[model samples]
Target: MTPHSVTLDLGGRTALVTGAASGIGRACALRLAAAGAKVRAVDRDAEGLAALERAAPDAVETVRLDLTDLAAAEQAAAGVDVLVNNAGLQVVRPLEEFPPDAFRLVLTVMLEAPFRLIRGALPHMYGQEWGRVVNISSVHGLRASAYKAAYVAAKHGLEGLSKVTALEGAAHGVTSNCVSPAYVRTPLVERQIADQARLHGIPEERVVTDVMLTDSAVKRMVEPEEVAEAVAYLCAPQSSVITGSSLPLDGGWTAH
Candidate 1:
């Protein structure tokens, strides 16, 4: 038997990326499109999804969706070879001050939605005998931070769910893995910065330095494209044996 090339060539394949409107999800959609995948780019933001469609008009199909709607998520997953569970939200506040509804909202989107999508996509992938699942977790998934109980707990659960999916999908030729990244320059992170500053009574600059980047040995935020490259790698023909893994693209945030 011969091994396939390390580089991904997704020509003729279809990929569905949640949260494809901006940030890491947008980057992953672009990269997968560049690798020849037919991308179903999904997000709650219609305008953002339209922008993504404009940027890759030929390769992308925009789908407006709220992952919190499990039926809609399942409908979106149909006929896709790759699933990128990237839709997420962040809320930073002291545990005692966290709103109950806000906590549930974050957990629902970040953890429950991904789980539902994976379950919905399983039979399709199993029937096809080839599939890939990429869950975009966070540095908080592997570690902890103050004022981020919901985000951290959801990410942690997502990582665990990915591992279980990997185990179950092994015999069916499907693989599941997570790409955990450090803070990136995205709208979500920017919002977190403002919230953290207000909560801690610190300058926004310090939020980046003392909060997000405090554990990162590299002293820089992870690039969205860098995380996308890892997604491309896992989608390659040769990465069949790479399931049940959480690959950190976190600027060495966990090294300490």
Candidate 2:
């Protein structure tokens, strides 16, 4: 964690953060709540939501709803001043062997759900003439990996969606951008390590150093708080001019 945080003052704003049960989403909910925004922490995990609310008992409102429920997801996003599309799951398999059902679920949660949430948030945002949409994209959004077919595809689609929202919402004082990070030190990625190990027939430690951090000049995994900090920066007053762009926290993976 950084010794000093870049404080963002978001008084009177209602921010709805998806995937708030853990990892990057949890950090964002906490950071925004600390910034004085009324945070609606949404996640499918009821117990995780409870834990998150306990962390900021007065500042965060917990909403437990699966994003796969498109209508419910849209309804949950209504009237939110800031929308953080951060909920995602990954399935690793080669193209011919990837389960169609899992692929469908991944896209539904990662891509279509963001579309519905953004749709629901737009009327309020356009009416108020001020809003922020921060999509928690991945480095896979920019670059592809072998067994992560579904994940890469969903993130790439999300990148396109974010840019389109930026273009359409530009005139209405709404800014939509993506914060793309490389391997984060989250359980999801830890599970991914196991998946990659099995796929490559390698040990778990070898998967981490050789596969996960191969392209990253900085070999260490990124912390969730770092990604959240970038999200907070994009929501600050200084970020009004940074629409339709991607902020990469990939430890210089793209430098190659």
Candidate 3:
């Protein structure tokens, strides 16, 4: 797909993006920085963060953080004008077989960390009378598939959290919304291929063609830039009235 341009004047804004090491988070960090925002790129992957620094020497500042460290995650979000909660991990297993620790970790990073980050960021936003909290939710937030119990649960929780934030933040000039997407061409998705195949008893190629894309009407994976563009749209000045919404980039997957 052809890449489209993003136009926004975030000249003096400070944006913090979690999971900024690669994939969708990386795309969003670059996109916002291109619009003139000073971006704090957060991820536990020091090497990936280093690559991001090389990609945009002056626009990005890299912070190595594991969202499991909830306090530090919250601290990193303080005083930022924009917060993008995009860090996530996945484990493909049935509910009963899902590891307990993995479940806790998933909820910690994908759900609790966002809550803490928002909690930390809201005060500064309220003081300034403006802020944008964009959670990188998933198609699973609205729909569910087998062998993804933890992921789906966390996303559903995130969706509810985003709505509540929107309501509380409305009067404070802060808007919280979610950008939910279907499978994208990212490292996370690529890794899931083997897991999905293992569980589904199919080859890796078949996992992509049969199980993964089964419900995607568009018949192709969404692009990271595409998701980044949607995030940018929600952050636009005109989007002030567009709070409490979950914009789906699911290729009509939920249409069914």
- Which of the predicted structures, 1 or 2, would earn the higher TM-score when compared with the native? 2
Please report, in order, the local distance difference test score of every candidate based on alpha carbons.
Answer: 0.91, 0.95, 0.94
- Positional deviation of 25 in candidate 3, in angstroms? 0.4
Error of 3 at 50 (Å): 0.4
Tens digits of per-residue lDDT for model 3, 1-256: 5354546779999999999999999999999998899999999999999999999999999999989999998899999999999999999998899999999999999999999999999999999999999999999999999999889999999999999999999999999999999998999999999889989999888998899889989989999999999999999988889999999999999899
Q: Order of candidates by lDDT, top first? A: 2, 3, 1
TM, every model: 0.96, 0.98, 0.98
- The true-versus-predicted C-alpha distance at residue 207 of model 1, in Å, is 1.6
Off by over 4 Å in 1: 1-6
**Runs in model 2 lying further than 4 Å from the true structure:** 1-4
lDDT of 2 by residue, 1-256 (tens): 8543676888999999999999999999999998999999999999999999999998999999999999999999999999999999999999999999999999999999999999999999999999999999999999999988889999999999999999999999999999999999987888788889999999988998989999999999999999999999999988899999999999999999
**Ten residues in sequence with the least summed lDDT for candidate 1:** 1-10
Per-residue error for 152 in candidate 1, Å, reads 0.6
Which lDDT value does model 1 have at 120? 79
Local error of candidate 3 at 88, Å?
Answer: 0.2
Looking at model 3, residue 71 earns an lDDT score of 97
